[model samples]
Target: MKRQPKGTRIRLLLAAFAAATPVAYGFFWSEVRGRGTPDGSSIEVRVPEGATSLEVAGVLAAEGFIFRPRVFDAYVRLKGQGRQLKAGRYEIPRGASYSYLLKVLQTGSVVTTPLTIPEGLRVPQVAERLAAYVGDSTATVLAWLTDPKRIGELGVPGPTIEGYLFPETYRFAEGVGIPVIVRAMVGRYKAFWGTEERARAAALGLDEREIVTLASIVEKEVRWGEERPVVAGVYWNRLERDMLLQADPTVQYALGEPRARLLYRGIDSVADHPYNTYTQPGLPPGPIASPGAASLHAALHPADHDYIFFVARNDGSHEFSRTLREHNNARNRIRLARESAER
Candidate 1:
């Protein structure tokens, strides 16, 4: 048999190669872009920790989300994202393309629950909100909060992590731990107290914790912004004169529940409680609630006044008084107005 000429053989080889290239390319595209399940349902895939890109591809393939794991692996490596796939449970569409799967895994787009903690929530209330965030029992969460070692690590002084968790809308990833959430909240609270706020607290002869404690009282006392500083002033004045703070909120705090109308019997019941301001003759042992930014600012910059008493106007406002007689008169006037209106 005679061998073919070199030129003729080369031409035949090129023709054959050219014919197969398009077919191979077509097959590659079809497989990479193809959907996974027949119904286009969403598929749940868990990528184990420290798993390589190829390993992730294999995992997805086992979950019936990918037809060709090598192609997925090649796609990941070609994009220079071999080590970028994060470890987490992912809810990917069954028909997700190579590009979509890579994007989701690389970005670590885990599902999150947005938790909005309102101001004035005590520690227990904060635990309740956290329970919803992480599906932990409230008791478990409270334990985490009150853990002495954890509280020490968090730089909080109290027996529990109270009055330090900042109120905000936080987007917590699913399966996130309680310690992470607590750190996040306390970190926000720390960030809020800048140099100027700290300096003001020093000028007032109060430490950072003391300011927060007073701010918490102001937060529970009045909801209106204008009244916050005024109410703080009355308390500050009382402190200066060594008079009882006599904050109704303190009585409510001692009772462990809010009362629509606090009676004398209720006050007497908790008279021995350390949180009762009427009997304590000063600020309570600590903050009664988590104060918001407004209350914190007001506590730092209380209105310079000699007002020693305040009567709630029942309209989110207060009538400040300079003396006991003035405060008593104001209270009587409010009572008379209420009585007359009742008739």
Candidate 2:
């Protein structure tokens, strides 16, 4: 082929450069445009505890909050972000670029407010904790719980949002919406109920809602993890025989009080309440607390025994019995143990 003239070659080079410029700019600008402008819009990003960099990238991509999560991975690789990524809430620019978002998450830049919902706490108590932490009124939290719109938004498969909110430590950003937190907690509950648990519940002829209700009862009965299955078995036996659960937790739930001790009057009051297992047969209307995985598992696969009663032992364990006579003896044993310890 004949060599081109110098000027023509130079012109050709310029044309090639011009052609490539738009493609390069388009790629770069697409990333930029997808990202939220840092001018005024801020977003809260959560880097889950013990999450991998790829998991974080997936979350960011799914949220549409970051542009190019691959860029997040690359940034983490270069900046050692993977090692430094902290589990907490982070405030970031809405539509932040993946690199910037990763950096923010890596540095724990999300403002964190601690919310602790203790085990066995009722919905009201959990609402109060969230209210105190979020600086929102407890009424606002309560309203959110009862708001059918909000509950629907969370996709909680029930009429009310009660018993769906998982109890655990949650770190929320300053501007994180309450609905978002509630949905996240509910999602946690669903996730915690793995396929195995679902299958077990199905085998037991129980649905998710019923399992949760039973789990809540088991949770109340089980002060110690070891005793959970035992208590669960007792409840299951009672349920099979058409006996009242006669659970004090249900009575306490009906009374809306912390059940350190049970009152005979309360159980015998006969005032109609859905949660009073003494008055009502079968599971309560809903869960009383967010049952952990253990409780849920126990609810589905109760211990193989004919136990119909259990009494709390002094060391947070329980004594199980098959019959009322056996249960009475166990109860007396526990009472004697308590008295001896008191002395």
Top-TM-score structure, candidate number: 1
Superposed on all Cα atoms, model 1 deviates from the true structure by an RMSD in Å of 7.6
**lDDT per residue, candidate 1, 12-118, as tens digits?**
65467558797766666677785555565677788888999889989988987778789888767767689999988888877787888889999998766688989
lDDT of 2 by residue, 1-343 (tens): 9998756764575467558897754564466445555577666667788888877877777767756777556546545457677777666666676556666776677686767766666678778978877789999888778777865677765546766788778777766777778777888887877888777778899888888888888887787787788788888888889998998888887887775778788777645887888888888878887777788778887888877877778887777777889989888888998899899
TM-scores for every predicted model: 0.81, 0.67
Off-target runs (Cα >4 Å) in candidate 1 are: 1-20, 26-67, 79-83, 89-100, 339-343
Off by over 4 Å in 2: 1-114
Specify the poorest-scoring 10-residue window by lDDT in model 2.
28-37
Clashes of each: 0, 5
Each model's RMSD to truth, in Å?
A: 7.6, 11.5
